[model samples]
Target chain A: EAGVTQSPTHLIKTRGQQATLRCSPISGHTSVYWYQQALGLGLQFLLWYDEGEERNRGNFPPRFSGRQFPNYSSELNVNALELEDSALYLCASSLGSGNVETQYFGPGTRLLVL
Target chain B: SQQGEEDPQALSIQEGENATMNCSYKTSINNLQWYRQNSGRGLVHLILIRSNEREKHSGRLRVTLDTSKKSSSLLITASRAADTASYFCATETWNTGNQFYFGTGTSLTVIP
Candidate 1:
């Protein structure tokens, strides 16, 4: 089976602009997770969507939001981007919620905000 | 931010040697997992150890979880140059089942 896939391997935007990143989970997976790996903050959880619902989120600000589609693919949106928002955004997928399952990740979208 | 902390932020060893990395978390977790990332690439799942389990092994990888200390360690034996990557430990807490808190990651460099 194909692994998780992400689009626009790299994104460039300026301050106050918005950025959208996409992710397609593996077949048969229902849970999609978003993470931000900043220069110093490491990899922090951004959002978790399970069965098309927002299950949980991380410490990120309201500007960072995303949604899961019916096909289990996900979209991460960063609004009013700041220079600090520049980082690698990763998307992962798992079997589903309520059980222990391995999470497979995508290559990640590197966003650079100037 | 219930993120975990990984010890020995960086490590460099010759091939055929053993590499061990440690992770410590803040809250109680249902399971702890290890992942490997090559530079800016996506992460690859290495191993997962449940709370009730103390130790588990797969191929040349061994993972040990200690709920008492809220810590876990990953051991990769007979390391090869291909094993050179950033290893991270993520935790799925009991309170938040879907969210995973990841550590800063330990960058390992295996020289051939």
Candidate 2:
């Protein structure tokens, strides 16, 4: 089975610009999660989407938002990007909230903000 | 901060030896999982131990959980150079809605 897949393996944006990262969950998965892995900040949860609803989000600012489509795909949008926004954004998916013990991750989209 | 913290920020060991890493989290969790990432890439799920469970093993990887201490440990036995990577512990808290927080990671280097 194909694992979670993400688009734009690498992205480059300038300060104050906006960036969009996409993720396609594995087949039959209903929950999609977004995370940011900065150099030293570790892996911080960004957003959680299950069944087309935004269940929860992390401590990130409002400028960081995302949505899940009907097909269980997700899109993460970072507005007013700053240099600090540069990091590898990872996407993961699971069966659902009831079976989230295991999450399969995508290769991640490396966003570099200049 | 629900993020977990891993001990021994880095470790270096020779191949065929054993490598152990520990993680401590802040809140109570439903389950804790271990993941491996090679060169800052996508993470590969290694093992998951439920709050009610104490230990689990997968191939050469062994995991132990101490809910009372809110800590978990990952042991990779008979390591190989290819096993070199950053190991992380992720916690799925009880109250959180399907959110899993991760640690800074333990960088393990297996020397040949």
Candidate 3:
């Protein structure tokens, strides 16, 4: 089966602009997760969507938000982007909403905020 | 803000050698996982060890979890040049079932 997929391989935006990253889960998967890997912050979970609902989120601010579609696909939107917001955004998909399942990731979308 | 730390930020070794990396977390967890990322691409799940389990192996990879110490270690034996990549450890807490907190990661470079 095909693995998770992400779009807009790379994105460039200004400080005040907004950037939207997209992710498509693997077939038969119902959980989608978003993570940000900044230069110094390492990899951190940004949001988690299970069965089309926002199940959990990280310590990020309101500017970082996302939603899951009926097909289990997800979209991550970062509003009022700041220079520090620039980083690699990754999307992962799992078979179910359970915590025991292994998550498969997609090629991250590199966002550069100038 | 909820994250762990991986020891030996970087490691460089020749082929046929063994590579070991350690991860330490602060909270109680249901399970701990290890992942590998090549370049800056997506991460691939390497192995996972549940809190109840002590050690698990997959081919050349062996993962051990010490729930008491809240630590985990990944050992790759007979490492090859193709194994060069960044390895990360993730922990899933009971409070946030769906959220997985990742560690800083260890970058390994295997010389051919």
Candidate 4:
């Protein structure tokens, strides 16, 4: 299987700018999750989309938003970026909801905000 | 609030040795999963232990989950240099939908 794939392996933006990151889940997977791994920190849950609906979100701000397409791919948009927004944004996919499956992750998009 | 907390923020061990990391969570969970991240890349699912299961093994990895204590431990036996990476424990909270809260992670460096 191809697992999961992400685009623009690395992104560079400045303060007040906006950056968009993309993620494509594995085939047959319905759930897409977004996480931010800041340097020296753990993976912080961002937003989750299951079956094209917003399922759950983490403690991030309003500017950090994303959507899941009909094809199960996702896009994360960070507007008015700040230097603190620099981190590795990861996307994960799973078979379905409930306790029956495990999440497979993408290589992630490294965003560097200056 | 983060659901899991891992210990020994970093670990370094020699090849052929055993590397163990611990995780503790706050709420009830449907299952707990362990993932490995090489460098700053995406996570690779290592193992999953359900709330009813005690221990599970895959290749050289052993995972033990204790529902009573709400804690889990991952042990890598006869480790190789390739096993070096950051390991994180994530929890799928009961009734919380599909969100999995992850801990900070343990950076393990296996020396050859």
Candidate 5:
């Protein structure tokens, strides 16, 4: 089976602009998660979508939002991007919305906000 | 904010030696997971141990969890250069579905 896949492996955007990163979850996976890994910073949870509903979110601002499609694929949109937004945005998928299941991640989209 | 904090921000060891990294969390968790990320790459799930479980092993990796201390340790035996990467510990609190808070991570370098 194919692993989680992300599009636009690398992206460049200017400050105040908007960027959209995409992720395709593995087949049979129902939970899609978005995380931001800024340089020198740990992975920060951005959002979690299960069965097409926004299940949970982290401390990120409302400018950081995303949605899960019926197919379980997800899109993370960062509006009014700031220079600090330059980081690797990762998408992970799990079998279900459970704490015990392991999450498989994609290669991630490296967004560089100039 | 990061819920977990890993010790020894970075570590270096020769191949064939052992590498151990520790993680401490602030809140009670239902389970803890370890992930590996190569430079410029995404993370890969390594293992998961529930709060009720004390230890778990997979291949050359061993993970121990202590709920009392709200911490966990990941040990890799006979490490290889391929193991060089950043390792992070993520925690899932009770009743939280698919929500995880990660630590700052430990950067490990296995010299050949």
Candidate 6:
């Protein structure tokens, strides 16, 4: 089975601009999660969407937001992007929003903010 | 705050040898998972140990959890060069709505 898929394998955006990254979950998966992997830092959870609803978010600012569509795909939007926003944004999917289920991840979108 | 914290930020070992990493968390969790990421790629789930469980094994990887101490450990035996990567521990809190909080990670280097 195909794993989670993400678009724009790599992106470059200028400071103060906005960036949109997309993700498509694996087949039959209902939960999509977004994370940011900054250099030298661990993966930080950004958002969680279950059944097309925003279930929770991380400590990131409001400028960082996203939504899941009816088909279980997701989009992460970073507004007023700063150079610190540069990182590899990953998307993962699970069978459900259960703490015990394994989460499969996508290749991720590398966002470079200048 | 990050739920997990890994020890020995980086490790270097020869191939065929064993590598071990440990993680500690603050809150109670339903389960804890270990993930591996090579270079700048996405993380791959390695193993998960439930709070009620003490240990689990997958191939060359073995995981152990100590709920009392709120910590876990990952052991990779007979390591290979391909096994070189950053290993992270993530925790799923009982009250976090299935969300996972990850650690800074342990960077392992297996030299041939």
Which residue pairs overlap in candidate 6's backbone? none
Q: Write the per-residue lDDT of candidate 4 for residues B1-112, one digit (tens) a residue.
A: 7889998899999999999999999998999999999989989989989889999999999999998999999999999999999999999887887889999999999999
Stretches > 4 Å off in candidate 1? none
Task: Supply the TM-score of chain A against the true chain A for every candidate structure.
Answer: 0.96, 0.97, 0.96, 0.97, 0.98, 0.98
* Residue A61 alpha-carbon offset, candidate 5, angstroms: 1.2
Contacts from the true interface found in each model, as a fraction, amount to 0.74, 0.74, 0.72, 0.80, 0.88, 0.84
Candidate 1, B12-112: lDDT as tens digits:
99999999999999888888999999987899999999999999999999999999999999999999999999999999888787788899999999999
For the second chain, the TM-scores of the candidates in order are: 0.97, 0.97, 0.97, 0.98, 0.97, 0.98
Top-lDDT candidate index: 6
Q: Which stretches of candidate 3 lie over 4 Å from their true place?
A: none
lDDT of 2 by residue, A1-114 (tens): 999999999999999999999999999999999999997557999999999999999999999999999999999999999999999999999999884459999999999999
Interface RMSD for candidates 1 onward, in order: 1.2, 1.5, 1.2, 1.1, 1.1, 1.0
Candidate lDDT scores, in order, read 0.92, 0.94, 0.92, 0.93, 0.93, 0.94
Question: Which stretches in model 5 have alpha-carbon errors above 4 Å?
Answer: none
Clashing pairs in 4: none
After best superposition, candidate 4 residue A38: deviation in angstroms? 0.3
Regions of model 4 farther than 4 Å from truth: none
Which residue pairs does candidate 2 place in steric collision? Answer: none
Evaluate candidate 2 by giving its C-alpha RMSD to the native, one decimal.
1.0
Q: True-contact fraction for model 5?
A: 0.88
Expressed as tens digits, the lDDT of each residue in A8-73 for candidate 5 is 999999999999999999999999999999998899898999999999998999999999999999
In candidate 2, what are the lDDT values of residues B1-112, reduced to their tens digit? 7569998899999999999999999988989999999999999999999989999999999999999998999999999999999999999887786789899999999999
DockQ of each: 0.77, 0.75, 0.76, 0.81, 0.84, 0.84
Q: lDDT by residue for model 4 over A1-114, one digit each (tens)? A: 898999999999999999999999999999999999899899999999999999899899999999999999999999999999999999999986766578899999999998
What TM-score does each of the candidates earn?
0.97, 0.97, 0.97, 0.97, 0.97, 0.98
Choose 1 or 6, whichever is better by DockQ: 6
